[model samples]
Target: MTRTAQVVVIGGGQAGLAAGYHLRRQGVDFVILDAQTTPGGAWQHTWDSLRLFSPAAYSSLPGRLMPPQTGETYPDAQHVVEYLADYEKRYELPLQRGIRVEAIHRDGPLLRVQTDSGAWHARAVISATGNWSRPFLPAVPGRSVFTGRQLHTVDYRCPADFAGQHVIVVGGGNSAAQIATDLTLDDHVNVTWVTQRPPHFLPDDIDGRALFDVATARRRALDAGRDDTGGVASLGDIVALPPVRKARDAGLLQASPMFDRMDRDGVVWADGTRAEADAVIWCTGFRPALSHLAPLQLRGTRGHIATEGTRAIGEPRLHLLGYGDWTGPASATLIGVGRPARDAARQITALFADN
Candidate 1:
């Protein structure tokens, strides 16, 4: 027999938890299906040294503030994982672990969510599976020929393994910068930062809080039907973490333009300059993990399902949460995700109310 729920939330990450929180508040009958065996979602997969740009208080989900970091100003990846686990336990949210959702499709008026464990017939489905699983590496010419070690940021752990090697870190984002800086800490490791364009860095004092404020403003402007060019910091702009700041002070944050292609041992620049390297760390970011929704034929260009708020366009029973700004402004972030999740919960509640 197929199990049933009023709602099924895919992914038990920050977004999924937030959505679950709101759903619980509204007395909605929902179950969050998480792929991972443990809690903390993608936070469990990030590198050990990775720290949030915001303090613990600022980087929290709905109904619960992340417990303050004792000695650390910013919470590390492990801390986040613990916090998420505690939040799950504290709220007693109904989350099923190790249930990887394979596909989602419409079953008459309800949605059918198929997982490795079983199927869930849900009145509404929230796809909160954030972008962690979909690391994107650009199609560079001769990438297939490179014999040296190559991995995306998702696979990166620490710079210790890369010690005494020439490493090329790709992309201009914070992840790229941070990884490059981390690699530079070991004198034996030669690091090169590559980007399509010069990276933009926010002011030293500006952290995740400021970025969240800017995002909130942009969201408000867009909601008011106005242009959202508020001249504030962008999510792509690098925040000046202590280590990043130290790296900049020591003249280590310099970035080079993207290389032309890859050779067997290294990368080749457009100017025909060749840099021999042992590894290429692609921090080119991630694409939305919405493949399960493919059966619905809801994906538009670039694998994105067009969304008004959290609800998928042309498919009212489906909602895409915590993917990115396209779903809702800064919906990918911890704090920003709450807005769309709450809105989705409200809408879903109203739909049930109508019946």
Candidate 2:
């Protein structure tokens, strides 16, 4: 069966929810399709110790502010899940959960979203599928032959699972740092953290709110053709989360240079030393989850679709929201996505007017 609307949104996560709120306000007929069976999207899969980089109020969707969590400077994953569920209910966004979008194809004057259940055609499509589904691990030598257990960010759950094991965490980003901190509490666990370079910890006072402001400033600078200032690239690699602070103060959070290669049961450094590890966790990051859009043949270098604002450069009717800075400054964050989402919805409305 083929259903139709003015817009079809892919990936009903934070990005999709933000766009849905704006599209509703714009009075456009739209539906958001989510692959997950429940609310919270990727938040549902994060490690048990995961916490927001920002305060609840600073991390919110467009239409609603996140309620403050009791005694929490950074809300936990479940709290975020509850907030997203409530946000969905409050807005009454036309979201269809448990529906996986297979591909999006051109259908005459419209675009067709082929899903496992059925098909939906729309005048425009918003691809908000964030990259959690596509975790990335760099090709370290002997990775395939490494005898130790290997896990990526997608497969990691809790540090308790690694208790008493020599765990090697690879990456300098927030996940590697936080997970390392969490692992420090596990009895008899030895964590060997390796990063390409020393981790850059943000100022103790600079939180997610500060970063969002920086992103806003950078966006405005780009708009004026001025030198870009204070984008995420200019900031530290890790936020000073409470656990991270405790671990760092205790001297448990320092990192060594990345290993040159992985051998059976461990990693080897360029200095001809080796550390035996029972497990290796790759907090290496992710690529955009855009396999469904492959049918469009629109991605260029960097495996991302080029964009003018939120609209795809090659397909005006498609808006690729919340991928990263290229789509919009900090659009990947809950707070930063609002401005770009508003722009995308407004552009979609204008496209209809032009038609």
Candidate 3:
């Protein structure tokens, strides 16, 4: 027998939990399908030194605030994981852990969410699957033939393993800056930063909270049908955190333009100069995790489904959350996800209420 629900949330991360909070308030019968065995989602696997760009007060979900870290202004990965576990217990949300969803198919007017353990028939489906699982690496020539170690940000753990080795870090985002800075702390490790373009850094005073406010303003302007090109900064740009600033002061933030191709043991620059490196770390970011929705054929060329707010334009029964700004402004962040998730829940409730 197939278990059914009024809604099925296909993730248990911040976005999923935010949706659950609003869904519970609406009294919707929903079940959150989490791929992991534990409460924390991707936070459980982040690098040890990773820290949130915002303080605990600014980084939080819908219902509860994240507890302030002792002696640390920004919460680290472990703290986030513990908070998520606590949040799950406090709310008593219906979350089915370890159920990796394999596929989602339309069954009549409902969605058949197939998981490894079982299937759920849902009147509406909310996909909050963020991008941590799908890391993207640029296809450099001779990359396959390079015999050195190559890893994406998702696979990176600590810089201890890279001691006494020459490492090349790629990308121009927050992860690239943080990882590159972390690797520089060990004087034995020689680090080189590469980017497609000059990296943009937000001023030291601008933190995640400021970025979120800018995004909110832009979203409000757009909603009011006004032009919003106010020269505000984007969250994707690097933030001048204390460690990153220290690395810059130490001259470790020097970035080289992306090399032309990879050689046998290293990368070759456009000027025919080759830098011998032992490892290449790609912090090139990620794409949305929507493989389970392949059967729906709703994706565009950019691997994203067209959406009006959180609701899928072509498939009304489906809603997407926390993918990126395309779904909602700053939807990928802890504080920014709640607004979109709440809107999605309201829409879903209204959709079923009319029936």
Q: Where is the poorest 10-residue window by lDDT in model 3? A: 228-237
- Assess every candidate by TM-score: 0.97, 0.98, 0.97
Q: Mark the regions of model 3 whose C-alpha exceeds 4 Å error after superposition.
A: 230-236
RMSD of each: 1.3, 1.1, 1.3
- Candidate 2 residue spans exceeding 4 A from truth: none
lDDT of candidate 3 vs native? Answer: 0.92
**lDDT minimum window of 10 residues, candidate 1:** 228-237
Query: What TM-score would candidate 2 get against the native?
Result: 0.98
The C-alpha lDDT values of all candidates are 0.89, 0.91, 0.92
Backbone clash count for every predicted candidate, in the order shown: 0, 0, 0
What lDDT tens digits, residue by residue, belong to model 1 across residues 1-355?
6899999999999999999999999999999999999999999998768989899999999989999889999889999999999989999999999899999888998899998888999999999998899999899999999999999999999988887888999988789878888887678789999899998888899888888788778878888889966635544578889998899889988988899999898999888999998999999999888889989998678655788888988798888898877777778888788888999999999988897
lDDT of 3 by residue, 194-233 (tens): 9999888888888889888888889888889999745245
The parts of candidate 1 lying over 4 Å away from their true place are 230-236
Model 1 residue 304 CA deviation (Å) reads 2.2
